[model samples]
Target: MLETIGINPAELAASETLLKLLISTALLITVVVVVRALSARYIRRNVASMELRRRWLVHSRNGLLLFMLLGLIIIWGEELRTLALSVVAIAVAFVVATKELILCVTGSILKAGAGSFNIGDRIQVKDFRGDVIDQSLLATTILEVGPGKLTHQRTGRMIVIPNALFVAEPVINESYTHDYVLHVFTIPFKRTANWQAAQQALLASANEHCASYLAEAKRYLKRLNEYRGLDAPSVEPRITLQMPSAEEVHLVVRIPVLTDRRSSIEQSILSEVFSQQEFSGAKEKALEQEGSAPTG
Candidate 1:
């Protein structure tokens, strides 16, 4: 009859496969529905507790669904295998053609899986440091945070970074503490200047500026450590001396500050330290001497 209608052998085989799959699927669905209904009725009648009845009904429905799924897979196994091979070939070619897009998506998956950072969290990838403002599958948008890290000031520009960079580089999460963070900044002094006095002044300024929230930051860090099973670092203001060159001494200061107030707090500390008579005395003397000198 198919031959009379001009259907070739290959077309006949394909039509038979489709018909068989459809009929088998319908029969499986019908069987599953009957079994589910019967089992639910039996469970309700035989089970004493409501919870047990619910559990049994759920298990029965799930088992029936699984059975139907298995039956369908068996019925269409050969066709599915052929389709899967074609899909694999297409996918390989597509990946090769769009390798960067694939990498960006893969990076997004890695980021989501790792719980790396979220909107409003400050993150640094290579030289790009900013607060994450938006995230998409292919890229992340951030408000650029610095001319350099030490400035801790926004450049008032938005940067869209490809998500693929996350896979290739490390992401530094600066706001891991959420509310507050141990912020570090450096104050460099001339080796010939009153280095000891400058150190004292800087330490005093930090202590004064951070005194209000110092205890609170310590407690917050303690709780975080306890929650994460980590050893807590000291939150008290610290100034460590480092001599990077013969002409300079860097007084590295670390203190706790609200995540959003890092730049302000740093500015306050620097202003307070620099305004002191001890630090400004040399400049004042130089200015007075210049003024007394004959006019050019």
Candidate 2:
């Protein structure tokens, strides 16, 4: 092999430069593999903080790859700079072809580092609503829920939202720190229906499911108000009764709805309220029809 390259086998064996370059390359590769394995294992086991673990995993992998490539350049640079420059040129060309993706990746890193959103947050961005499952460089994954016409079954649909939208569009964070939301269920029945009785029953049902949430919400609200530079906030539950139409009485029951139990709590309160309400013969048929439909 050395003869074909116009060098004797002994001469090639004596080349210190070639041997040093080969040794450097091998060490660089070994370092990358060892660091990646240790980092991935540490993140998977010991880190209780999800966001920190994610950041560490990403930066660790990228740092190792970058260092290895830099080492290769330094070790074999005298002979390989031209090759390295060509590789860089090709990478730049590929990035230019995927500019949007590059921006999304950059945005995701910024969002993750700045703590814009985290796993388990119920958020809506770019017209998609779901609980965030995980975030990547270019996109964030969501467990789909609560879009008009979609319900239950986990939806099973994963929405990949470009993180760049975080800068361009507004995000709705429903479960930022507090997991309880105030859910208002309004009941309208003919004037003859027992509106007051229905309201009481609905309120009672809500309390059965979420009475503890009210206290938690109060504490959360106080903290929120203080953080926003406000005075002590109201911690009372408000229920209103009204006659929205001449023939109809309206009962609005406002109660705390746990984040995970929103749909269940809503269904329970609605079912109980409808069961307890009294209606006319014709109105009874309409009530049954409405009951068959789903409520958001």
Candidate 3:
């Protein structure tokens, strides 16, 4: 009859295999259901504590379901292998077509296994910086953090970054400490400006504004260091001078500030430095000198 319908031997064999698989699956499910029911009844009768009885029933049901799954897999293994072998070329093509999707899923798995970052973490991946707002298997959504890293201001934009990038790039967590962090920012000045005075002004401003939490930051860092087995970095405000070009000076200021208040604290320090008499006077003098200098 199969031959009359144009079904070849291979097709007939596959049909038989499928039918057997279905029957076996149904039988396995039925047995699992019976066993689970019996186990639950036994547990209810034998177990005195309600919690323990509930636990036993849950565990038994799970075990039975797992057993049924394994049984189905075993019963269908041969048929599945044959189908896979026949579709080797198709499978290869499918995989090639969905390579990026596969990579995204793999990257998600890697992120989960590594526990790299979580929602609300301020993370930087390659050129992207944002506060993580949502995470899915394929991508992460962030509330954009900056037009530049130093700004510490949200751009009011949402960015979706593919999880695959997490596999390819390192993620920097700016809020790793979750409370306070040592923030660094640069202030550029002309070489002719009173760099010493500017440095003093910046340092004084940093110290004054950051004084309330300096000790706390220090203690927190020390505790973190002990917990993580790392050397504790200083929480004290410090200024390092750098010459980036022939006529420019960069005063790098490092200070400990609360993570959420980074921008406000930085702005306060800048305001105080710019408002200082000595620093402003020096800046004016430098500008006058530049205006008076000979030019071609």
Candidate 4:
């Protein structure tokens, strides 16, 4: 057609090459759209896990991008060798420059694949502890939990953490297979106080408050051992002593509770321990002794 208009041979070749490139790109785009639509429809119909389905869709999109790049190289090979080489060089540099972003996306893929943690799973990475509430390509959002507050209550803050941190930090899946958490807290007393009695009182309180947890834990652990042969330790209520100083003794109570009910469970335990006659009687005795002493 160009020859009929008296165009030169070199210009004609360039035009033909450009036309081929356009056709290749158009075909690649069409294939991408059709494949995604079909895959999405199939996944939505057949796949059960929402996370797994989303991951499959994401993988398909990434595969399409790679296919488009490869198709471009094949379409423009011989005559456009210099252009392709330049494009490859630029792509390599871009990938290197955006390494963190690539890592985050890669981390998201790995997270989905490994079933590391899911929405509502209680997890701790580094100093951040919370329940995962949202996940995206770049970051994960968590309903923040405590250190500054008692009862393991949420700080009423949402934390947005980069997904790439999953690779960089140790991920602690606290409530992975089970929907329960080990709520551990310490009740301190003076060294002269009846610390052994306090320990007993706390243990009794935990056992009372964790009635359902203890039952569920027994069933959960039995299944785990029977199926996976996990040589797991006892999940029964326990009280361990920690002496921060010679003057201070802490009775640490460790017991299981539903993950979302951490604060309430802690409150219940605390209330029970404090309400115990031994605790209040000890406090009144201490006050009386202090009062009877010289005012020097």
| lDDT per model vs. reference | 0.85, 0.72, 0.84, 0.77
The TM-score values for the models, in the order shown, are 0.67, 0.61, 0.69, 0.69
Predictions ranked by TM-score, top down? 3, 4, 1, 2
How many residue pairs clash (N, CA or C atoms closer than 3 angstroms) in each of the candidate models, in the order given? 0, 0, 0, 0
Q: TM-score of model 2 relative to the true fold?
A: 0.61
Candidate 4 lDDT score at position 11: 80
Once superposed on the true structure, which residue ranges of model 1 sit more than 4 Å away at CA? 1-84, 87-89, 278-296
Runs with alpha carbons beyond 4 Å of true place in candidate 4: 6-84, 109-114, 147-151, 225-228, 276-296
Candidate 3 residues 139-251, lDDT tens each? Answer: 88899989987789999999999999988899899988877888999988887667788898788888899888899999998998899899999789999989999988899
In model 2, which runs have C-alpha deviations exceeding 4 angstroms? 1-36, 39-96, 147-153, 183-197, 224-235, 239-253, 278-296
Deviation (Å) of 92 in candidate 4 = 4.5
| lDDT for predicted candidate 3 compared with the true structure | 0.84
Model 2 C-alpha lDDT per residue in residues 53-132, reported as the tens digit of each score: 77677667767766887888788888776566669878888889998887897787678676776777778776688877
Give the candidates in order of lDDT, highest first. 1, 3, 4, 2
**lDDT (tens digit, per residue) of candidate 4 on 178-211:** 5665667778888777777778777887888887
TM-score of candidate 1 to 2 decimals: 0.67
C-alpha positional error of residue 231 in candidate 4 after TM-score superposition, expressed in Å = 1.3
